[model samples]
Target chain A: MRNELNRVVMRFPSKSINEGLARSGAAAFASQLDPTLDELGDIRTAVSEAVTNAIVHGYKDEIGEVIMTMKLFEGDEIEIVISDKGCGIPDIDQARQPLYTTGGAERSGMGFTIMESFMDSLKIKSAEGKGTTVTMRKRLNTRRYR
Target chain B: MKLIHDMKGGLLTVRLEGELDHHCAMDITARICELIDALLPPRVRLDCSKMPFTDSSGIAVVMRSARAAQGIDSRFTVAGLCAQPMKVLRAAGVDRLVEIEEEVHI
Candidate 1:
């Protein structure tokens, strides 16, 4: 049996807006534990949504760095922290709403919703001038390797 | 994903083989849109039998595809959705927007 992997960190500038990079990073990180496609998809979606939110909403077309940190805990749960040093959400409540969008035409405001739906647990912190950080947790029950 | 189309009849069927996440959502969406616009299909069927997992981005892509089909006056139906994808669609209230075919035994 392979030992559970600990953590991975990746950083990308907001100007690039490459979805492939984020998803590939997620797949590679989760593949270390030999998770099933179902588990992998769940983690991939959460990471994608988080990275997208950081790029589109937090950075808001401005150039900044978005960092993603992923760590597996106790051979069962995965914790992920995605952060961006950009414009933060003034009103976190309104931002978390299902379809409430600050962006006029570019964003759909579904990033947080998708992240919450895919991950087991999600927490967000942001300040007016400071940046935003999103911490998400996902549990892996089955030991299937694929 | 394997997409089969009957151009003369204006019918397109898409068989999704694996998970539909951000990795494949854009590609699938672009392909579906191109086919629908190019052929002007009367109806489109999305077969999700083999698709075990789909994320919210996948749902967004599906919504976009459905909207594109509607814009062209084409009917779109999603069929053979298993547990995971079905739950995600239901949670997102996508069934109300698109016609989803339930399990049918032949």
Candidate 2:
């Protein structure tokens, strides 16, 4: 395990509007690591996907609390965890599959696929009626300057 | 998000400005579909040059737009996608569903 250098925890309502806030906040916090434009974009997109799942899938039609935790390690690595206490995923494998969604016609079902591709690693844990939690990690490329 | 539509000859071009996400996808998709259903143009084009950011929700917008255009027998094409949105679209294999062009001068 790398030494934990800094961390931030945010708690907000599981509203559709908060999706943008979550991703933008994640990008702002990740900027401390001096990530490049591509890295920042990847982080923002991954965060958006996870937060959207929590809001759209986890809580369903009801409003609940969505918690996000971001941690930075010694080696330019960042880890983000997004969790929601809502109706959990019945099948994690199926949910992770690309284009597989219960989110109706408006949903592309590509949330998990985008997150998995953009980040280095992804882990999801869920219980039928309990809740869902997603954790993702990525290490930015080392740069010569600063 | 802002949507600008230009209908010239048989082409209906809709320009998207601002971020496309779940928060705004519903309205955007509906507007585009409404336009397609009303105009029934021979060709439909989405200009994404000004759209700097998008999530999987953007995929839904694109897919819905494509479906709307298909309903009217209109050809659909997406042009001038920036890097991040393009990555998300390609990751979802959206290029296979609709015609994707890198840039458009006009």
Model 1, residue A133: displacement in angstroms?
0.6
Task: Please give the TM-score of chain B in predicted model 1.
Answer: 0.88
Q: Pick the candidate with the highest DockQ.
A: 2
* Model 1 per-residue lDDT tens digits across residues A57-126: 7887687888988888765678889999888999999989986876533244576887888788999999
Best by the lDDT measure: 2
lDDT of 1: 0.75
TM-scores of the models, in the given order? 0.74, 0.97
Query: How many clashes show up per model?
Result: 0, 0
Angstrom error at residue B32, model 2: 0.5
Model 1 bad stretches (over 4 Å): A1-5, A15-17, A103-108, A142-146, B1-6, B13-39, B46-54, B79-87, B101-106
